[model samples]
Target: MTAEPILTISGLNVDYGTGANGVRALRDIDLTLHRGEVLGLAGESGSGKSTLAYAVTRLLSPPGVITGGDVHYHRPGGGEPVDILSLTPDELRAFRWQELSIVFQGAMNSLNPVHTVHSQLTDVLTAHRPGMRAAERTARAEELLTLVGISADRLAAYPHQLSGGMRQRVMIAMALALEPEIVIMDEPTTALDVVMQRQILRKLVELRERLSFSVVFITHDISLLIEFSDRIAIMYGGRIVEQAGAAEIYRDPRHPYSDGLLHSFPALHGPRRELTGIPGSPPHLSAMPTGCAFHPRCGKAFEPCAERVPALAPPDAGQDREVACWLHH
Candidate 1:
């Protein structure tokens, strides 16, 4: 059964500056994250994957600005949607970790080098749950460590004391400290080895199942998403080119960019295949190509691809999927 929508992003647009000098980073992006499911967002380095995460969390700084659109969080237990964009400073602070939390890319480095793990974990609780006593906070901190498969003994240790995976798990522990309904993880396993990455993702999935919180896992690793995500959304040039069930995307990708991304990863179990990296680099937002931004590199591009933008819509197939390409239209 399809889960209820937990977060709805409508007509979302982002730009770097104001007026003509501004460069568009995101354009009319629409997405829905369902309750208790892992939604994977994947693309190349500059495809605006991180930007989308930061924008959704309102963590974008300086020149980054939300030009338009609304991000609505559908409160659990069937409450009215709360417009995140409309939140005031105090409301925004209270809304952040208590409702939506993010485990940023390279999150391990985000830990404070000087503070003990116990202190860091408790700080979140102290800030959010002011009524809790100091002893209660310490006990909860230990429990959080144990929940992430780390020993409570490490709570007193500094950030440098733990291994890479342990540190990453510590970050996960912090994000879950508040038991938020949605957790946005931006490439949570960037430098970890394959085995470690798989282990972390597996543990994350296990925790999600038990905790019942939705996840927006961002990564450039298509294969990892194929293994772990319930649904996959492929981004190209700051827009989602295709989105569908993970298996459907792997079996039959509709967009040319999606196909390219899927093929970029090496196959492990299938017959040996040569890896073909996506041709050409992504277009610069300042001088974006007319029409489809990917048309410059898309092998399937025709005259229309260069002249008109393709709206994301259902393809000829009846499957529950959406694609943005003139070829499908």
Candidate 2:
């Protein structure tokens, strides 16, 4: 039998406010995360990829509230399943980085410009494991750095003194400081150039192999997801349109949006040509249409698409992938 999921989200709805004031950032969302697997969430900007990540980690800012549904986080610590949507501030403090951690995009900002890498790394160790003495913390910091392919000597250098790739590795080291079972990486390599991006990606694969932690990776680049993730979930306008194994998603995209996204990237070689994007932008959350949010830009959208929001249903039992598009369902 399959193991229970480490992170389970069901009917998750995040609204900006009350009644008519409500803006649906996410609606009827569902996801399951298994141990030691990478689940990639891909979408264009404003499609609510980050919103779902934020909601999962209980990190959403003011005005955005979990209006309905549940986020059930099952940790190895043997505590009751945490209802992340209802966490108190004190509870959240105890949970962050210990049970759940995030590697934010532009994570360089997370590192202090003035402090040495040793200091920053030590801070996370000290905070999470308060019983650890300086010597223990130092050893732990060095161990984590080694895991990311960086030497312990670099610990003496400040953030500004490091290259972009090194700084990114340091940030990753800090996130792994707590050795949490799960890490939510929100476009973690967006700011880096291609080479640096690959370097980090390689290290992440290595780190995951060593630590055996699951990852909820969010990004706009479908090609990167194909390279780094085990499975992919395609999000469009606050809803999941398609989800499947990365190979299957690319090999045969059932949804038109997924197809467009797959085609939008530049040709890798020969020409290295400039690419064109999908026709329009994601819908404004404050003012969404009555039917499908993607119908405006979806090529296969027809009469039924304008009148009903299709559920994520599989065409057959043999095919495990689920898609919400009317044409596919």
Candidate 3:
């Protein structure tokens, strides 16, 4: 069954620094993540996928500011939606990990080398569920490890002792400790090999099914997104150029940037074809093109594309998908 919308992002804009010299890292972005569904975010390295993830979780560091936007999270039990952007520091602390958790990029490296897996897992529960007794926390830690496919025996091992994939799974287990309604993973598999990456993602989907949490999976790999995501949103130069169902995007992408990204990866089953990557580098945020930031790199660019920026909207009539390009206009 299709789940109800869990999070809504509207007119989201992020900038680095303040003043006329500030660079726009994310354009006005509007997106919706449904409950228990996986939404894949794809783009080049500098396209602001990670920025959006951090922005949503209110985790962005110094010099980064949200110039405009509203991020709303609907309560799980049909309660009134809360404005995430407006939460106070104390409220944010209570909200995170309980309502939503994020597994950051290179998350395996984030584990404390000095602490055992058992200690770390228990720490999260200890902080959030202060009333839980020591024995209960220990049992919960072992259960969490088991949920992520890690044996309870590994609980006493330090981060350095675990393999890279195991470390990633541990991070995932920690994220799920609070049973948050949503989990945002940013390039969680970057350091793992292909086989391990596949295993981790597959296991993640299994856990999602069992736990009923939505996912915002951010990665630059379009092929990976196609295989795992229910819906895919393609971003370029910090703006989303296209968004649609994964199958619809793979079969009939409406934007040139999305098409370019799809073709950049080779298909394991389909007939062989020459692999050609998109030409020209991504636009620098400081000197982004006036109209469309992707126009210079888009092979399908034309007169109107260079003169006026196209808003993300549905193409023609009777289509649910949206694209930001003059080709459809």
Worst 10 residues of 1 by lDDT: 311-320
Give lDDT tens digits, candidate 2, residues 158-240: 98888888888888888889888889999989989999899899989988888888899999999999997988999987899
- Model 1 TM-score is 0.98
Provide the TM-score for each candidate, comma-separated.
Answer: 0.98, 0.94, 0.98
Q: What is the C-alpha RMSD of each candidate to the true structure, in Å?
A: 1.0, 2.3, 0.9
How much lDDT does each candidate structure score? 0.93, 0.86, 0.93
- Where in model 2 is the C-alpha error above 4 Å? 1-3, 77-80, 267-276
Model 1, range 245-277, lDDT digits (tens) per residue?
Answer: 999999999998888988898898979988787
- True lDDT of residue 322, candidate 3: 96
Question: Candidate 3, after superposition: displacement of residue 14 in Å?
Answer: 0.6
- Runs in model 1 deviating more than 4 A are none
